[model samples]
Target: MALLDNGVWSKRFFSGGWTDSALDHPVVEPATGDLLGMVGLATAEDVNRAAARAAEAQRDWAAASPQRRAAVLRRAGELFTEHAAEIEDWLVREAGSVRAKAGFEVGLALGECFECAALPTHPQGEVLTSEDARWSLSRRRPAGVVSVIAPFNFPLILGLRSVAPALALGNAVLLKPDPRTAVSGGVVIARVFEEAGLPPGVLHLLPGDASVGQAVVEAPEVRVVSFTGSTPVGRAIGEQAGRLLKRAHLELGGNNALVVLPGADVHKAASAGAFGSYLHQGQICMTTGRHIVHESLLEEYTAALAAKAEALPVGDPAREDVALGPLIDRRQLERVHAIVTESVAAGATVAAGGEVSGSGYRATVLSGLSTDMPAWREEIFGPVAPVLGFSTVEEAARIVNDCEYGLSVGILGDVGTAMKLADRIDSGKVHINEQTVSDEPNAPFGGVKASGTGSRFGGAAANIDAFTETQWVTVRPDIADYPF
Candidate 1:
C-alpha cells in the first residue's frame, strides 16, 4: 500500500493543500530494509512560506466562534478513529513501531484530539476583585502561529498532542515532522484536519530535517515553538527561540529509571520492567533505561527480569507474534549495540540477551552497573536496561535523581514508601506500582531539569496556557477620577 501520491510525498501543506518540493528524501522501512516512499524535503524558503500562510490563517481561525472550532476538532477526532487502521499501518512501516505501540500512539493521539475539542469551551479567563472601583480580569488569547517539531518516536501522538491543542486554542500551526516518518507524522495528520473541514492555511505540515526546523523556529511569524525530540536539538531550538524572544515548549530527552523496592513482588516488578525497558524497542523518551533494585531483591529481580526479557519474541514488526521490532535504521541499531558492548566491557555483566539479531537487538539486561558508565547516565534509546543495586530508600532516591535527565520514574513497592521516595526523586513525574511508559490525555505531561524546559502539555487548561498568552484586563468606569 503506497502512502503517498504516486509514491511521492509532499513537503508542504498550507491553506491550499499538499504541495510537492523538487528535493525529496527516501523513507525506508526498517524491518525489511525496503523503500516505502519518498518524502519531499522542505527548504528554508518553504519554512518561511508555511509560517506566513499559517499567520494569515490564524486571523480567521482565532476570530471563529469557540463552538465552531470545537465542532471541527470533535469531527477531527472522529475522523482519526475512522481511519485508525490505515494510520496504524503507516506507523508500523514508516516508524518501525510494533502493533501494540502503533495502536497506543494512535489511540492516545485520538484522545488528545477529543480532549482538545472541549478546550475551546472551557473557562479561559478569570475575574478578580480589585481594590479600586475597577474589575480586573485575565483573558487567554492565541499566540498567533505555533511551530511544532516532532520526533520520529511516537510522532503521531506527540505531533497531535501539541497541534490539536494549538488549533483549539485559536492558533494556526506549522508542523515540521521528522523526515524519517513523514507519512505517519505529517501526511496523516494533515489529512485528518482537512477532512474535518478545517479551513486552508490554518494547519500547515512540513517534512524536513534540522535546517528546515531551525528556519521555522527562527521565523518571526511563528509566535511559539513546541518541540519533542533529543536534548541536543531541543537545546538548540530553545536557545534560538529564546534569542528571538519566542515562546518555546520543549519535551526533550529522558533517562528514566524504574525502581523495585524491597518486599515488592519480584514477578510483577519484573513484568513491568520488561515491558517498560523493551516496549517499542525502547524508542520512547520515557522508556525505562535504568533499573534500580534494592540490594535484597536484586538477584531475584534480575533473574526474573532476565527470564522475561529472554522470552520476548523479537522479529519483524509486521509479524503478529513478534514482541519487539527493528530500530529506526542501522545507525540506531549500531548505537544500541555499542552501548551494550561498552557497558559490558566497563565491568557490567549481561544478565540477559545482548547480541544484535536480524533487524533488531535482543532485549538485553545488564547488572552491576555503576553511575560512571555511559549506559547508566546517557539516554540509551534502546532495548537495553542496566540494573543497579541500592540498599536503602535514600540510596535508591539518590540513584534515581543522580541522572541528568529527570523526565519520569517508576517505583514498585509499598504505597506509602513509594510515595515518600517519589517525593524525593527529582523527576517531573512518578508512577507508583507502574512502569515509566505511561501517558494520559488529560494529564499534564512534560519533564524537568535536562529532560525538558519545564513546560507542560496534554491537560485541558494547561494546553490553553501553553499555546496562548494571558492578558490582564482592568476596566475603570471612573477614569476621570484618576490622577490625570
Candidate 2:
C-alpha cells in the first residue's frame, strides 16, 4: 500500500497511456511522514493533449451500444468492491482516513458507479408537440468532454460521483485529482476503468495542482466542468468556466448547522451533533460546522458532546485503532488550530480537547460562542464544534440561515417542528432527525449560494442535466422548406 505500483496498476503512477511528464511530486503519508510514492505533475499542455485524446475517443464511445457502456461501468464497480480492502489501506496511508471513513468512501464510490451503470439504459429523450404536420422530438446527447476536478478530502467519492455518470452517459472525462492524494483519487479511478476495458483515452487521469485544472476548464474539447473543493477555489473555477461559456457544477464549502430543539433527547442529540461535526476530523464539506441548541438543553448538550470528545481516541489511522485520524497536513492543522485560538481569544470557552495531539488536533468543543466568533462564523474544517444557544425556534432557524454557504443542515427534535423549520433554510440537503454528514446514490447532492453553482451532481435526473445536452429535431417527409 505504501507504493503506487502494485500488480493492480501498471506504469507506476502514469495510467493514462500517455507520455510520462518529467515533473513529479512525492506523495508523503502525513501521519508518519513516510514516503508513499511519486505522482506526475501535469502541465497546461498536458491538459490540452488529454482533452484532444478524449475528444477523439468520445465519438465512438457515444455511438457504442448502451449495453456495452453499462457493462463497463458495472464491472468497474465490482472491481472496486472486490479490492475494497487494498483500496482502504491506500486511503488510510495516502489520504489520512480512518478505517471506517475509508470504508464509507469506498462504499460510496462503488454505489455511485453501480448507480451510473443503469443510466445508459435510462430514457434519453422525449416526444415533442409540433405546431405543423410533422414528427417532433428532443434527443439527449453527450456533452462531449467533461472535466472533473476533485479535492483531497473525500477524493474518491467526489471524483467518481461525476466521473462515473459522465462516462456512463457517453461523455469522456479528464480527471484532475488533487496531487496530494493522486493514488487514491486519480490513479485508482484510471486503473479501475482500464481493468474494466474502457477504451484507451476515454478516461484520462491527470494528477496535478491548480494550473493544470485551469487548463482543463479552458480546453476547447471540454464542454463541462465539475469541481468539488473549497468555496474560493470553486469561485475561481466558476469565473473561468463562465468566461469559456461552459457548465461548471461546483460542490463547495459549508458552515452547516445542526440544530437541537427544545424537546429532543439531550444525549441522542449530542451524539448526532458530535458525529456530524467531528467525523473524519471534520474534513467533510457537510460537516456540522455550527451546533445550534435551544437554551433549555444547551448546558446538558454541550457537556455531553464535550464528554464524548474527551473519551474518543485519535492517532495514526493506519497503525492504531482510533476514532479520528490526523488532519491532511500541517497546513490544515495550523488553519484549524488558529481558528480555535482566535475564537477562544474572542470570548469563547473550550469545553474539551483544545490541545494538539501529534499530527492532529483533538476533537474540540467550544462553548459560550457568541455567534460572531471565528469558531462559530467560519468554516473551521477541523474537529472543533462551536455551540450557539438560541431561545426560540424562529431564532434558531435564523441562526442556521446566517451562513454564507448553504450546503447541508441537520435538525433534531420534534419531526413536525423540524420539517416546518426546514422550509426556512436555504441549504441544498436537509436531514430532519439525522446529522448533516450524509448522502445516498439516488439523492441530488449539491449546494446553493457561495457553496456551489446551484446545480446538483447525483441521481439520474440530476446527472442528465449535469452531463448531457438536449437538441430538438423535426421531420416532415423530406425537407419542406420554411421561411427561406
Candidate 3:
C-alpha cells in the first residue's frame, strides 16, 4: 500500500520541481503510523525564490484571455473528476479520512473548481458615475500572488476553496498545506494544475510547518493570505499581515451551537446534533461543540444523541468499513482528550463513549454542561458533544449568543420561528432544520468575530473581493487646465 512509488510523485520535493534540497520531512500515515514517503522540506530562501517566480509568471497569466483562464480551471475540474479514486486513496492513507468523507471532500473540491471557472467570464469591472465630464470606471485586478495556509482537517476542500478561485481570477498561488497532510492537501493540487497545463510557477505547493507559513505570508511578492486554522494562530497571522499592510482572510476556530427549539422532534434534532458533532470525528471548524436544547427535551435529546454516538464504528478507515477514523496526529488526540477530561472534571457527565480507541477517540456525548466548562467554552475539535438546557426561547438565544466565537449556528424548529431566532444569533451562517456542519460551493462561506474575517470566501462576489483589488480609473478625451 506504499504509494510514493515511481509511478506516482517520486520527487523528493513536492512541486515546482525543486529537488536539490537535502532536508526531508517524513509523510506518515495517521491511522497505521506507517511511513508513506519523504517530501523535500522547504526553507525560507526557497519560499523567496518561489514567490519571486510566482510574481514573474503572474504577469503573463493575468494577460491571458479570460476564455483561456476559464478553460484551464475547467480542465482542472475535469482532472479532479477523472482522478477521484486515486485522490481519495491518497486522502484515506495520508489524511486518515474515512472513504465517505474523503469522497465528499474531493467532490466539493471539484465543485469549487467548476464554480471558480466561471470567474473568468464573469464581469470584472463596473461603470461608475462621474461628477466630472470624464468617464469613471472601477476595474478588478489580480492580487499578484496569494498565500494559502490550510489545516489538516478537510484539507482538500479548504485548500482548493481559495486556491482555485485565486488561480481562476489570474492570481498566482503559493499553497502551504499542513505537513501532516502534505500529499493529499498540497501534492495532489500541484499535480492537478500541472496536468491542466498551468504555467510553471503559477502554482507551488510547499509542505512545511509554521515557519514556512510565516515565510509565505512575509514574502514581498505575496499580496493576500488565506488562512484556515485555530484562532490563536490566526491572531498571530493577522497581526503580522496587518503590520505588512497585506490582506489576510482568516477562518479561525469556533464553538458553534446546535439549538433544539421547542416543538422540534427530539429524535430528529438529536440526529442533526449527532451529525454536526461527530462528522469526520468533529475535527471540522463548524462542529457543534454545544447542544442547547429546550429544558423539556433535554433528557430525550441527550439520550438519543448518546445512542447514535455509541453506535458509530471507529477504526482505521483505510482498512475497515467505519464511520469515524483516527485523529490526524498525537497532538490533536491529546488536545481533544484533555478538553474532554477537563470538562468532566468541571462537573459534566459523560453520557456515551468517552474512551480512546486505538489512534482515534470514540464518539462522546456529555450532559449537564455549564457555560464556564472547558468543553462548553473551548472549541473541542473532536467527536465530543456537550449538552446544555434552556427554559425559554430567549434563554436559548442567550445561550447561543453567549459564545464569543460566531462562525455558524443551527436552530431546529419552524422556518418562520427559526428565521426570527437566526436574526438574534450573531453568526456568519445559520442553518434551519439542518446541522452546523454544512457547506455550499456557491454560498458565501466565512465567519464573523473570532470565526474569521467575516464572509470572505464563497460565491463570486466574495472570491472577487478576496483575490482581486479594485482600482478606480477616470478617462478624459483632453487634458483640463490645471489650477496652477
**What does candidate 1's lDDT look like per residue over 1-484, in tens digits?**
4333534344344335778686787878888888876777778888888788888889999999999999999998897788888889888888888998899988998898899989889998999888977899999999999999999989899899999999999999988988888888988888888888899999987777778888989988998999999999889888999999998899999999999999999999999999999999999999999999999999999999999999998888876568898898899999999988888899999999999989889999999888999789889899998999999999998889888899989999899999899889998889999999999989989899999977479797679879989999999876546465
Q: lDDT by residue for model 2 over 360-474, one digit each (tens)?
A: 8899999988878889888889999999899988998889888898999999999999988999999898999999999887799988888887657888999988999999988
Measured against the true structure, the TM-scores of the candidates, in listed sequence, are: 0.97, 0.97, 0.97
Question: lDDT score, residue 170, model 3?
Answer: 96
Q: lDDT for each of the candidates? A: 0.88, 0.89, 0.89
| Backbone clashes, candidate 2 | 0
Report how far residue 217 has shifted in candidate 2, in Å.
0.7
lDDT of 2: 0.89
Candidate 3 on 269-385: residue-level lDDT in tens? Answer: 988998899989899999999999888888988999999999999999999999899998889899999988988898999999888898999999999878998989999899999
Off by over 4 Å in 1: 1-15, 478-484
Count of backbone collisions in candidate 3: 0
Supply the global lDDT for candidate 3: 0.89
**Model 2 pairs whose backbones collide:** none
